[model samples]
Target: MKWYALLVVLMVGLGLQAQEEKDIVVKRTLHLMGSTFEISVVAPTEEIGYINIDEAVSEIKRIEALISSWDENSETSKINRNAGIQPVKVSRELFLLIERSKKISEITDGAFDISYASMDNIWKYDGTMDKMPTASDVKASIEKIGHQKIILDPDEQTVFLQKEGMRIGFGAIGKGYAADMAKELLISKGVKGGIVNASGDLTTWGTRETGEKWMVGITNPVEKNKIYSWLPVVESSVATSGNYEKYIVFKGEKYSHIIDPRTGYPTKGVTSVSIFSKRAELCDALATAVFIMGRDSGIHLINQLDGVEVVLVDGDNKIHKSAGIVFDTNQYVEK
Candidate 1:
């Protein structure tokens, strides 16, 4: 959810004419969940649109207020605070999102569980740990971690955690869901073409005003500010999860921040994972799931699910892609 500042630079080469572009790009940064959100939208400048961007921002805020686990007054926080005591009724949208997360958990065989929030924060990645946790520690931390224990009542739009301390939060899928909802809202408002770049989780509709597709650069996990691949995205969502973003060295071993729900321990051996799909929510959730599932199982899971593609960067810097991903190899040559 952290807003890594996005630098949108328009480069003009020498002798190039500055023809007026018909596209309009607007960016707004807002504070949410202890992080800054960078939202960008692109559309035709001449389109007769009545949709107000402020209203769209407000909608996003409402969704955040409903699902933020850190917010003590939020619905999700209430469910966590009252775990096993009651079934908290939530908005229909939140209820559906929880249902979808559970489905993903089933698909990944608990690799993408939302119940990991119930785990005790024993593994510190902030450079203070001396050694890895014992097997007993791992087991104890995940004692309350299980997706099967989460009960959902569709009719009542309620979620109940069967375990006393069980919890569910959308840290992995919230931004993507927000991006998808925003895109859908804008499309319903008759906005022709734009890209909703929610940090790295991006969803797009229609093409640029120049009739070309919106292009996205996949950053090289090993190299900063260098793109290893480029994807021309049109009406698709892309999301990436990587251990390279945050980690700590413990007893000469580096542990990532992305913890496995089943083990209550961070996953190793994988550097980064990227998923592309029709819905940003799916892409977002799957990217984290695949990162925890590692290379082989992750690739297999993605292949089984239709309309999903993945690009996995291994610890050795080798790239493995899913069957649905179609990219030019020439574009991925290691520099």
Candidate 2:
């Protein structure tokens, strides 16, 4: 009788441990820079332990305060305000982010430019009907959109935009950077095996409780909830950029919200681009750059880089993928 009771207790304990290994989801919403950001983290309930969600939220807000351009007192805003004159010293963190952004600019040959904010908000895509801007207007906008004008002083940890009206915003890279930082923070706090999902930009570490990989659904551009393909992701970051979010129709032509800095016009040929990389920051910036570069150049760029893969959907819904991506064709409806 004593032996049977001990065996029963051991079995119950094992069952509880197994149950705890199931995936746990924690989410929070915070208002930052006039936008509501929804952050979700998924991890095993077991392992080392769980991180304090409140602490994670506070850390995210701290990063937001440092990087948000809408804040007049932010490091980036100060540098923008002092453009064309002297370099304004900034925090080491901001300086490193700027340096990384500049490297991406070089890699994409200005296709992923940070100076794009210099362009005037001439193209309105919010359901307004109007003819396309004139040639002169386009030319004027392109004149101020050169990444070459940005100067960095490593000694002073400063950034200087050569044009007075020039500005640098991290609309493309901020969320991914935030996700990376949050993941690092969580890991440092001894929380292992988790995912930090910032909207569509997602980064995951470790396998699920069943020892299987985390499954990520790549959304179809035409259909919001419908996933065109499901990819197994682990210890990788995925980011997607599509023109379907915001666009304008002018003279029977549709233009995307993502404008090419070089020509000051919407990029053509590609409709959506999804990038898989080890770093969330690179994945984030490259997704935008690849979308702007179109299918051919985008493929060339991803192929040249090691450990980076791409899945591109053209305007006509044709899907193109890099050699590195592995998945089942039957799971997706081929276009």
Off by over 4 Å in 2: 1-23, 29-51, 219-226, 332-335
TM-score of predicted model 1? Answer: 0.88
Report the poorest 10 consecutive residues by lDDT, candidate 1.
5-14
Question: Cα miss at 296, model 1 (Å)?
Answer: 0.4
In model 1, which runs have C-alpha deviations exceeding 4 angstroms? 1-21, 43-52, 220-225, 331-335
**Mind giving the per-residue lDDT tens digits that candidate 2 earns over 1-335?**
00000000000011122325465544556654344444444455423233445556677777778888888988888888898878999999999998999999999999898777788877877677477888899899878777789898998787899988898888788877877887788767755555665555667776544455666666555654455667777788887787765777767777888888888888878777888898778888998899889999999999999999998888887878898887564654322
Candidate number achieving the greatest lDDT relative to the actual structure: 1
- Compared with the true structure, what per-residue lDDT tens digits does model 1 show for residues 33-55? 45445554554442332243555
